[model samples]
Target: MQIEVLVDVKTTLGEGPLWDAQQERLYWIDSFDGRVFRATADGREIRCWDVPQKIGSMAIRKDGRGAVVSLARGFHFLDFQTGDVALIADPEPDKPNNRLNDGKVDRRGRFFAGSMDTMEEGPNGALYRLDPDLTVTRIDDGIIVSNGPCWSPDGRTFYFNDTWSGEIWAYDYDQDRGAVSNRRSFAKVDRSRGGAADGSTVDAEGFLWNALVYDGRLVRYAPDGRVDRIIEMPVKKVTSVMFGGPDLDILYVTSMAKPPLPRFPGDGVLRGSLFAIHGLGIKGVPEPRFGG
Candidate 1:
C-alpha cells in the first residue's frame, strides 16, 4: 500500500476524520486541543474551527450543513460557518468526570455516543442513542472507554469497542427498529503488543478496520473474526481510520503526537499528522448522517 501524508497540522490528539463527499472535503477533530479541522483532499487550504469544549466525535447532519458534536457533558449541533452551537441533550449531569467519546450514526439515522470517565477510574460510562425526535436512550452500560461503532455492509451486524478491556463486541442489529441485541465477542486486542483499540470503520466487504492506538498500526478483521490484514504506520498513537475520496477507495488515518515516550522509539516524522493510504483494492460505504 502507498501511504501519503494528507495534512501536517500536528494536532495533539487528531481523530474523528469524516469525509463530506458532496463538498469533497475532510473533517476531523483534535480532542485535546478543542479544535476542529477542515481540509481538502490534497492538504491544500486547511481551516480550523474552535468549539467550546473538546469534541471527541461528531456526525454530519442530514441536510449536509454541519455536524452534531459530542462534547464534554452533552451533545450539540454545531454550525459549520459560524461555529455556533445549539444544545441537544445532556444525559450525564451528575457524572462530572465523564465525557462523550467515539460515536457514529446508525443505519436508522440515530446518533449514538459512549461516555467514559476521563480518569478511567471505573465503569461509569454508558452508550447512548439520540433519536431524530430529540430523545435520548441508554442502550449499553458498564463501559470504561467506548470506541468502534460500525455496521456491517448489510446493516445486520453492529460492532463496538470497549477500549479499557481491549475487546470488540458485535450485536445483531435491527435497522428498521433501531435495536441491537445478541451481543457476542467479535475480536479482542492483544495488549501485550502494546496497543489498545481505538476508532474503527467498516469497508464495503464488511471488514472492520481498527486502530491499535499505541501500536502504530491498523488491523482489519473479517466478518468471521479473522485477522485479515495489518497496516503498520510510522507514527505511534494511531487514533482513527476512515475511507474517503470520490470512489471511497482512499483510506484516511489520524494520529496523535503523544509525548513523554514514543511507542516504537524512532524519529517519528509523521507523528500527529493525517495520513492517506490508497490502492488497497477496498472501498468504503457512505457514513450515515445524523437524522436529527
Candidate 2:
C-alpha cells in the first residue's frame, strides 16, 4: 500500500476524520485547537471554523447543512454557514473535570460519545447517547479516557475503548432501542508493540482497524479479535483513522504535534499532518449521519 500526506496543517491534536459521501467532502477536527475543517476529497479548497471550546468528535446531519459536535463540555449543534454553536445537553454537569471525547454515529443515526477526565487520572467520565429527538442518555460510566467508538457490520455489536485502560470492549447493541449491554473485553493492546487505542472503523468484511496512539501502528483485527495486519505510520502520535475517498478505499489518518507527557516522549518531524493510505483493497461502510 502507498501512503502520502494529504494535508500539513500541523494540528496540535487532530482527530475525527469524517467523510461526507453525499457531498464528496471531508470533515475533521483539531481537538485541542477547537478548529473544524472541511475539504474536498483531494484535500483542496479547505474551509475552517473555530469553536469556542475543544471539540472531541463530529457527525454530519442528515439534512447535510451542518453537524452535531461533542464540544469540551457537552453536545452542540454547529452551523457550517455561520459557524454558530448551540448547546444541546451536558450529561455530566456535575463532573466539571471531565470533557467529552471520541464518538461516532450508529447505523440507526444516533450519535454516541464518551467523556474523559481532563487530568487523565481518574474514571470520572461516562459514555452517552444523543437520540434524534435531541434527548441525551447515559450509556456507561467509569472511564478514564474514552476513544474509538464504532459498530460491527450487522449492527449487533458495538465497540469502544478507554485509552488509559488499554482494552477494547464489545457490547451487544440494541439497534432499535439504542442501548448497549453484555459488555466484555474484546481485545487488549500489546503495550510492547504499540500504545493505547485511539480511533477505529470497521471494514466491509467486518475487520476492525484501530490507530495505536504514541506508537505509530495501525492495526487491523479480524472479527474474532485476531491480528489481521499492522502498518507502521511515520509519526508516533497517530491519533485516529477513517476510510474516505470517493470509493471509500482510502484510509485517512490524523495525528498530534504536541507531546502529551514526559512518559510518551519523542515526536516525529512529520507529526500533526493528515495522511491518506491508498491501495489497501478495502472499502468501508458509509458513515451514518445524525438524524436529528
Candidate 3:
C-alpha cells in the first residue's frame, strides 16, 4: 500500500526537512522562496524566516541556531529566533556559478555539505566538510547534483547521491578521524522508472528512504539495495524527506511545486506541497549540533 498523506503545505521548492527532538518541530527550506520554515506536525501555522540569499541546506546548531548555506556568501549563521544572519565560511570564492546544496551534520557534530553548479552547466560543484573549529575542507569533487549524505545507524557507512547520475554511493566513514573511504555503489536507480533519487534519509532500522524526484514517490530500500516499500506522493519533485512527529512514525516530505508541465497534464495541481505519510515506526536521529 502507498503511504497516505496526513496534510499538505503549499511550499515552492521545498527541501531539507529536519526534525528537532528537543523542540519536536520540523524545519525545512524553500529554495525558490529564499526562506526557512518551522512548523508543527499537523501542518498548522508555519514560522518562516527570510534569508538574504538562496539557502541551499540548513541544520540546527548546538546553540539552537541555524547553520545555513548562503548561496554566494558561503556558510552563514542564522539566528532562528531573531532572524539575524552572519557569515561563517566560504569555499569557492572564484566560482560564482556554484552554491552549497544538500548537507547534514554527522553524529560527531561535523557538518558535511556539497555544492552544485548554479549555472546548470558548471562543474565546479564539490562536497565539503565543516569542522567544529569553523574550518571547511573539500572532501569529494566532480559532483553535478549532490544529495543524501545519510549515515547508517552504526555510523560506519555513509550514503550519498548524485541525482543527475541516478547513482547513490556509499563510503566507509571514520568517526574519530572524520574520513570517508572505500567509496562504492550503494544503489543505481533507473531514471525511466521515475526520476533519480533526490534527498534521502536512513531510518532506525537502517533502511534507506529515498525521495524519487519527478516520480511522485519515496522508496525504501533494504541494506542489500532491494526496494522494500514504496510510498506515493501527490506532488513530484520531492526534494527531501525526514522522520518527524511525536514518535517519528510520521514521514514528512517536502516537494517542489514546479511549473506546470505543458505537455504533461495534471502537473500544476500538485506542485509545491508538503506531505505527511503516517504509520511508519521509524525515528530519525536528531541532527547533532556543532561542538555538542
Residue 286, candidate 3: Cα error in Å is: 2.8
Highest TM-score: which candidate? 2
Give the Cα error of residue 101 in candidate 1, in Å: 0.6
Q: Give per-residue CA lDDT, model 2, range 75-171, as digits (tens).
A: 9999988999999998888888889999999988999999999888899989999999999999999999999999998999999999978778899
Candidates ranked by lDDT, best first? Answer: 2, 1, 3
Predicted structure with the largest lDDT when compared to the true one = 2
Q: In candidate 1, residue 74 scores what lDDT?
A: 94
Candidate 3 error regions (>4 Å) = 1-9, 70-72, 259-266
lDDT of 2 at 80: 88
Q: Give the per-residue lDDT of model 1 (tens digit) for 1-292.
A: 8999889888888889887777778889998788888888777789888989877899988887888999987999989878898889999999998999899998788998899878765899999988988899998999988888889989999999888687889999988877889999999787787788999999999999999888788999999988999998888689899899888899999998654234243327678899999889999998888888
lDDT of 2 at 68: 97
Clashes of each: 0, 0, 2
lDDT of each: 0.86, 0.92, 0.78
Comparison by TM-score, 1 against 2, better one: 2
Q: Is candidate 1 or candidate 3 better by lDDT?
A: 1
